[model samples]
Target: MPHRRCSLWLVSALIVPLAAGCDDSAGHDPADDLPADAAAADRGSDVSPADAAAADSGRDGWIDGDGPDASGDPPAADAGTSSSDEDGGVDAGPTLDCGARTECAGRCVDLATDGAHCGACEAACDASEVCLEGACTAGPVEAWTVDFDFGGGESALVEDFAVDAEGNLYVVGTGRAAPYRTLPGSRAGGFVERWDTDGTLGFRQVMPHLEATGASPLGVAAGEAGRYYVIGSTVGAYPFDATHASAPEDRGYVAAYDAHHAIEWLITTDLVASRQLERHGDRLYAVMRGQEANAFPIELEGVRFTTDDGIGFDWFTIALTTAGAVRWGHGSDTDDRANGLAVLADHVVRAGYHTIATGGGLSSHRYQLDALDHDGTTLDGYDDFGVPGGSAVAEGGGVVYVAANGPDGWVLQRYIDRTLDWERALGEAVHVSDVVVDARGRAYLGGTLSGAHSFDGEHLGEEHDGWVAAFDAEGGLRWVDIVDNPAGSLWVVMKEVEVSLASGLVYYRYRVTSRDGERVVALRQPE
Candidate 1:
């Protein structure tokens, strides 16, 4: 069962009172009184009784009650209706007969339609939201959320997520081994989970653990024809294939799966790690980083790529066919790191940081963006943003947006045809993890905030809060939303943000430092 958080409702003048028909006959179902569209939006039949019980436990800020007397137990019917028991203690009044409604604070509330108690006892919908089929939704937009955990004492880290053409979501992460015996002496392995458009989990495949010490899937991309790809690094022999054993060093692997979750093809490389993967049309592009000295004269797709001196780390970008055959591969012999990758109509863009050795043995980092032809030829110059790298890149409508950390704060720059279009400085103390653009030329950035910072007019400076913000093509701020962490959690960081082309909904994947493993939230783009 998937865990869900009930939408919050403002308690001031915006609170909508419960319907008077809630106190009707005992057998009356409140759903019948709802509007035709609202009644059709109800998804209560999809939630099992165990799921409802779990939601009642108040897991992810969805409390079961509202005030001091908001316990799961029913309150006294009247203030003076209590009676004394045989032991001289005051006995509480009889529980209210709410019929089909739930008793919250001594009042009967229809959980299915009551905005004040939408899904749980005293749970409230947002001010702009209405209770529909036990879930809070904003008009025609359906809110989808799910929380995933591996098991007890096991930690899971969500790396990336992608939405398929059918609106199904796929999340890739790594899970630490639990105390119980599964494959003895295994440390950790990777996993991929899929959720359908209706917020139901389709499948979860935990990778087979052989004798590998660590296996982490760092990136994922959804392709055509119900195909998806996962790229990661592993130690010891590759866990996905036993026939092709690798040395004890870190090796990168990319695996393609069909609609039935069966592996269609797998490719392993001598590279250290795979940073990012993007699929565009009939081709797939990926960027990887590794030390050339570790594996000299690396062979990828029968092509030999050798570094200049094998002294510094190098980054490689490769284009591959849908059948896992490499078409072209390009490598850079420098101390550079791969942060983001995006494919355009005629070029593949790579964004990251490059380290330059200054005088007196000091090194300085500068943001680097490179454009390459589809045949692995480097295009002429790209404008230097003069900021530190570690940036993320996204493309939409032939324009590219890069988000990087600048001396003043975080900078978002727009580029067209390798030329600077415009730039904006977001506040300081903010680190951007990923940036994505929707089909409508709207760019969205997701990251964590440390100190006080302002996004347009909204202010969010919580210690470690996750946030997502949107921007128009003309560099105007749309809106920003702060994804507050649950109480008592160590921190929360948004790892990736993806826009569903089919549904036009934005999905955010974040990790909470609490016992809750990872959470995926979907929201419709506001008009």
Candidate 2:
């Protein structure tokens, strides 16, 4: 793979540089690319100051001076081990012991680049795999070859999708008639469908209450026990309503269904706008944005919303037990809108934007990322000013990445020590829809870019296409690709993108206009 290095020119967009050696080439082992003179330098002689400085700077793109022992001085030598010091004396950092042999997959193998035990214990590789940058891979995994079109007339649109642990796919959106019988009050509106791994439809259930309420499915989240939840806003009155609907009231709703698309429970809340749903542990987390709560003590089973003190748009987060008991609820005190939610480690991270006044009542919105403990106590938080869209967070390898549309373009921020480590941006201004970080520290971002755009140093022709980009751990661009119509007449707009950590594949849904009607298509890409 060719290294896609970032330009150092600092423009309006805060473009950052990616290290040259960070790219992973097909079948290329990183250990084999080490400088030939490294062994001689390790002999404790002929070491130059510049060479030490280069190592300290992390020119190789791995460990940097951010480590505790990287203080620009020769580290204290461990017992029975020595290396050349700054003054040509014997001193060095701690030595690495691979024991009698490198351990991998519960067995001892080689250390100088054995594929099974490349550099550390249990770092086993597949058959015929090579150790590149200390990572093992057989090769590029096959991406999905899926094509689906529903409601072929003028009504099809996909909003979101999710993959369960068993690799089953769940897609939710608004469309035509349901392919199967649905729950009572089901109408010709939003629908939820399940598919096998090979793109075969298992069942499609028309999500009800949308026809009368004029609501559509916004997001879908699959639970641990083979259950799934769909959240959206509806105008119709439900079984739990306190008052029958005289007119359309935008009330938020969350419904749980079994693997066979049978409704288990349905919940409706006074909070009018629902954004998304996420499941963590045994609790279901739902986020919504609603206007000032005029009605105090609006109650749902085990949950309540009160805004007796203020009148403005509010974002609320509610946590519920598997059986639908609200465990806790949190809400913002400002005019904030909830964008997304994720459960990372022992904390729940909520991302969105809140507005701040500039002067004379004019205001601009800034993105905020808040981390809350399991019990809903606020912990560390970050505020990104001036970005139009709120930042979205994804966790991988204990690192959290936040992506947003900055003043100039799409920006990705990395936080280390709960503080900003690096901020990177793409050159062109594009509407970023979603972002996902992988276990290997790579970030995959999807959105639509109009006209011509550049990724790293590579340029593409002018076209309106849904674009997906990959960035290495060091914030270097790996590759950029586009999804467009072969005829080049239709505009492909990405609606949502989801990544499967287990399969290391990206699944995205987009929309394009055809002669028959509007078509919503889903495609997959290899990680």
If scored against the real structure, what TM-score would every candidate get?
0.69, 0.64
Which lDDT tens digits does candidate 2 get at residues 1-527? Answer: 01112211100000001111121100001112222211111011100111112122221111111111211222111111101111322232343233554434434445433444556655665543434434553322222323233213333445557777645567665543322222344434555655444333434444323223344565788776668888765554432212222133546777776654445676666565454687765778877655555444445575565432434356666777667777666666433243457666677777767677799979877777766776777776554433666456666665677787766776888765456778887655565677766667677677776666666445452456666676778897765556654353465555555655553345555545432222222222223
**Per-residue lDDT tens digits of candidate 1, residues 198-314?**
454454444433442344566788888778898876555543432333346546777787765556787776675554788888789877665546555666769765443453357
CA lDDT scores, all candidates in order: 0.58, 0.49
Q: State model 1's lDDT.
A: 0.58
Best by TM-score: 1
Candidate 2 minimal-lDDT segment of 10 residues: 10-19
RMSD of each: 17.7, 21.0
Off by over 4 Å in 2: 1-152, 180-187, 208-215, 238-250, 296-299, 302-309, 333-338, 358-361, 383-390, 439-441, 459-461, 485-491, 513-527
lDDT of 2 at 214: 41
So what's the TM-score on candidate 1? 0.69
The pairs that clash in candidate 1 are 8-125, 9-125, 42-133
